[model samples]
Target: MDDSELQAIRKARMAELQKQQGGASGGAQAGGSAGNASNDQQQSVEDLLIRLVRSGQIQKKVSEQELISLLEQLSQQESKANKTKIVDNSTICELTFPTSVLKVKMNRKRLLVILEEQIYIYSLKNMELLHVLPVRSNPRGVCGVCQSPLHPFLAYPGNNPGEVIIFNTDSLEPVTVISAHKSDLAIVSFNPPAGKGSKDDRLLLATASEKGTLIRVFDAVTAQRLYEFRRGSMPTTIFSINFEPTTNKYLIVSSATETVHMFKLGEPAKARLRPSNSETEAPAASANKYFTSVLKMLEPQRDYTCLRIPTNGNTGDTSSGNGKTKNLGSANHINREFKSAAAFCKDMVVVVTSEGYLYQFKFRSPEFKDGELVQQYSLKSM
Candidate 1:
């Protein structure tokens, strides 16, 4: 059946299940009886979803938000207490901790909880506490989890500055550790796995340091340096780093500036395995850098295309404005003057700003070099 037909079936089945459960909840007694009925209702919804998946009426890799919406619908008539715990039904698990949570990221199989100083990994099947990893001062809870079920990896900051620890969530062990930069890390992201699911495909990770001048893509399995894209010379806080969802060919980076950069990942540099404590520069390299600084300036890698959102509304200047582009660098705890984020959503480039504006641009295919502003709208009430 087509997706729309399958969705109709899912809605009909869920509505039928909701009606039956709604009638059952009416006569439920208070205290333990009400709790038992609530649990039964949650399980009934779960069973209905399972049958739909088995019957090929629902795709296993559907959006998590849609599943959560369905779960909330099932529990909408339950007690307020039960409604609070609806996430348990959607995720098939729940976790409680003594400390406040810094961040939470999950996929189909595992749930990762980041606290102030420690990280917890748990199985979604039974809420089994799998691993507890001690980390440094991660107040931002910087962590990247691979969404692909086949390439089950999780990346979090290591104990030292700019160190990234890649761990295999499936095997419950460490994969590799990469010292990505000389300064502290600001953002860590993994490229979405290729849609074709090849056995030879290795996970690719992208990291931006607090320096913010450059973004490095690495081989997650081998701890090798692959490609580095120079954002700019000036330092600014990077807001987001996102790889295109399906092909993983293009990377979108947003920062303190109004412009959003999209880099097409062409061929990468020769993979060089990083050595431990390799911070010192060689004499020949130092001499070359000094001469390049004194005589000719070094050329940095340029972005394939960029979109600069108009500060005013649709009447503002639409051109991406020419000049030397800046890197998405660190603001060093300074208040961001401006903020924006960009990502590839289907065939269009989507940009959203903190000033309450959403912009969409369409790019010509094949080369994908230029962008045409197709839509713009204000998110705030004027």
Candidate 2:
């Protein structure tokens, strides 16, 4: 009886030890699998961050301490392949100028850099000095250049308050002089042709004055005012004004005031038709003014520092037609002012803020009740 009982207890004890050892090994393998998964995720994020930095999409300087902290976090995961090392071997190519650069614009194959009293044109291919154009006391570097193939010219505020001088970029010669306003000129722009095959005969020129009260459009070929609209009675700075591409059916205006205005262009008249009976027709003096009318005035839910509308003929209506505001959960709270904005796609806009945050706003047309927040990216985190 004693020997059989002792052998049975020994067999059961041996099975218990084997089962416990197997369970411990299984737990260790599961923990290792988890670590590998984390390492893989960290590696993916590192690669994307580095690619954006090299492409100049993410522009920020990371502190040494912050970079070291990131590296330590990556190394904590048990994978040698995921241990990322931050490198600062970026080489910068700089173009030296005698004076401080005020504005830089690229047109076709030329690089135009505006300086205090002169505008320097450089070849884009090799950065060779092409020409140096002199100007009269341009302290603010207030100038605009047109890149349209139909009517390509460079314009800047003239010596007089109400003038603008247009210059041909190729010939380096003055094309024409325009007496645009009674007050100083603020900005000048030539309408961009709708398409590559479009004609330039109907292209128009837009100008804003320092008073910021009047915005006028003139025929590029005839140099005659086509229409004039009043912005506001109180003088303010005009941030930007753009005409819709191709059709010229709409105009977008932004000013110092925290509002953006869209105006619908009226149909052009070739000739004023006379009534069959002169008595039935209204007198010329009593006719209604043929100015562009404001279609919509938008004040963004979050105040923007800069705003822009796309003129590439791709922007169309973005309304859902259901009259509902799309709810985008607040993952990234925008606490800073917007610095600039541009059209990203047919119904999307990309806005950059002063705090180095990039926001993508979808459903962003005058037709929409509210712009839908699609995505938020922290550029500073890079």
Candidate 3:
């Protein structure tokens, strides 16, 4: 070969070596972030390093067995920053992103991170990046995932307003796209998995819009409409919407108003449906009879149970025996960004407010008329 050609080959070889070193260094930094990685994270790191070597992104001078031994040493090494070597079991691993995190949701097998325009799904076991899903410009981080391990599904806003994509995380495919509302979506939620014997159990999804008067539920797999619920006649911001985690029979809607509404689902509500009594059956029977009439209905279904959070008490001036602060302030003095969320835990209704108060109410009777506040906890103290 001519002297000029030899020089060119040497330069090319030097560039290739530099590229490989850069790739290896990046992988090492990712591994170092998981200082106290769980066994799963360590295994994932080993798998990644092996793949890099096999793909020529990492040099093959070192055998795979030697690389694995080095990984073991790194995993066992204590962080120099913590001389005491104290381990925090609370956090399993850490994930970094370029953009700010708008929302995060997790299930048994998956962890979802929602950013401004993309959603990232990671495996819960090993914290491996499973998918990067492109979504509409969702500044509010509107997204939901089914908690059921057997049938995992994710829902997010699609390209168009009011459109939602139902994605099957296990199959790594889009199941269906639903035109939930005409306006932009304010909330997207999925009912808890049925955990039934049959794997084909229907996955139900709920959605609300910027005009948060109406809430709709759909069969995610089939794109079939299941239920339509009315929050109120007036338009207000919907704060949070969640299904009863256990039974999936009751749906709770919280909004800007002080009142929280709970509605009974009709069809496809069979997951762990609590045994019906006279009081419960009365409402369902009346709803069925009313809808069966020959006359068409103008409004959607009304709330089955309504719980109004008191906004008129003393504004943090007084303290109860348990030293918990009283009502934050009058309705007019409430924070403009105040948000409220409600969930069902066994028979009690748990309500949490952004003002740092949590109230647990239990129904006085089967009628479920504004249950008495059985317990109160100051979230700020915690």
The list of candidate 2 runs beyond 4 A from truth reads: 1-94, 196-201, 268-345, 348-382
Tens-place lDDT per residue, model 3, 122-201, is: 66555566667766688777788787776688888876689887777766666566778899998888887653553435
Task: Estimate the TM-score for candidate 2.
Answer: 0.54
Residue 207 shift from truth in candidate 1, angstroms: 0.3
**What lDDT tens digits, residue by residue, belong to model 1 across residues 1-382?**
4546644643454354333322111111112101111233345444544454466543344333433322422121212122112143243333455565555567668766666666776656655566677668876667788988877898988766888877777886566667788888877888776766533365789899877889888888766666778887888777678887667777878777766777777665542222334358787776766665533222335777766666466433343423233333332325545666666666776665656565766654553434556667553442
Ranking according to TM-score, highest score first = 1, 3, 2
Segments in model 1 whose C-alpha atoms lie over 4 Å from true places: 1-94, 197-200, 271-300, 315-337, 365-369
lDDT digits (tens) for residues 182-290 of candidate 2: 9877667666556555443476777888797777776655555566666656776665565655455445555544334445455333233232344555565335322
Q: List TM-scores for all candidates, in order.
A: 0.65, 0.54, 0.63
Report the Cα RMSD per candidate.
Answer: 16.1, 29.8, 19.1
Instruction: List per-prediction Cα lDDT, in the order shown.
Output: 0.60, 0.48, 0.60
**2 or 3, which is superior by lDDT?**
3
Q: Supply candidate 2's per-residue lDDT for 318.
A: 23
